[model samples]
Target: MSSPSANASEVLIVSARNGPIAKLTRDEAEQLFLGRRTTLSDGTPVALIDLPAGPVRDRFYLLLTGKNPIQTRAYWSRQVFTGRAQPPREAPSAEQAGNWIATTPGAIGYLPADHADSRLQALLPLR
Candidate 1:
């Protein structure tokens, strides 16, 4: 039988090959996505890319930030209206997100595990 963690769905946080980031803890990822952190561990400026609203997007935010979709939208709206931060760039699908992360310097995005590949470096796994 599989363990709970083994069975749990996971979203892979990925970056471009040769990007300054190596890996991120879940808390660090949360901070980045929440606009609380803007750079990678090596002090490289990074951009956040998000998958369009759907199961993978939902699961990634819920598991990493403990925020549901509605709450997340509200949070970003407040930040944007206050001129504090902009929401992440969004890709229309997992494939697009993966491709963006793979080719863009300092770009980071989450994808369902099966879409992860050598083109991108997996930084964190959020369940």
Candidate 2:
């Protein structure tokens, strides 16, 4: 699964020695990956992020939520106005997203599965 950013890279998760990262079930991952507010197995909050709206974001949204980006945004907005947690932060690009996850403590985001590069701590197998 080599990609542009990670031509010869291995993504190894770097997490706390005493505990696990917030791995999620597929269903849960779908929810978070699609910009729905989701929690990890340990009940930690998961923030789903994507580049502002584009082809890849559209595809990811559809794959994860079975809906288009516009619909996802509408749904996310409703969740926010209703006092639920905010939708995932919108990073401008893969570079911005990587930077955000790299620096933001207790936060997590994803990139191309192959290019994840262990930049952010990888969650365990979702159970």
Q: How would you encode candidate 1's per-residue C-alpha lDDT over 1-127 as one tens digit per residue?
A: 1223433377778888777777777777888898877886668788899999888888888888899999988988898898888788999887888888888888988887777777887787777
RMSD of each: 3.4, 5.6
TM-score of each: 0.88, 0.65
The global C-alpha lDDT for each of the candidates, from Candidate 1 onward, is 0.80, 0.56
Worst 10 residues of 1 by lDDT: 1-10
**Top lDDT model:** 1
**Range of the 10 consecutive residues with the lowest summed lDDT in candidate 2:** 8-17
Task: Specify the highest-TM-score model's number.
Answer: 1
Candidate 1 backbone collisions, by pair? none
Question: How high is the lDDT of residue 50 in model 1?
Answer: 96
For candidate 1, what is the lDDT?
A: 0.80
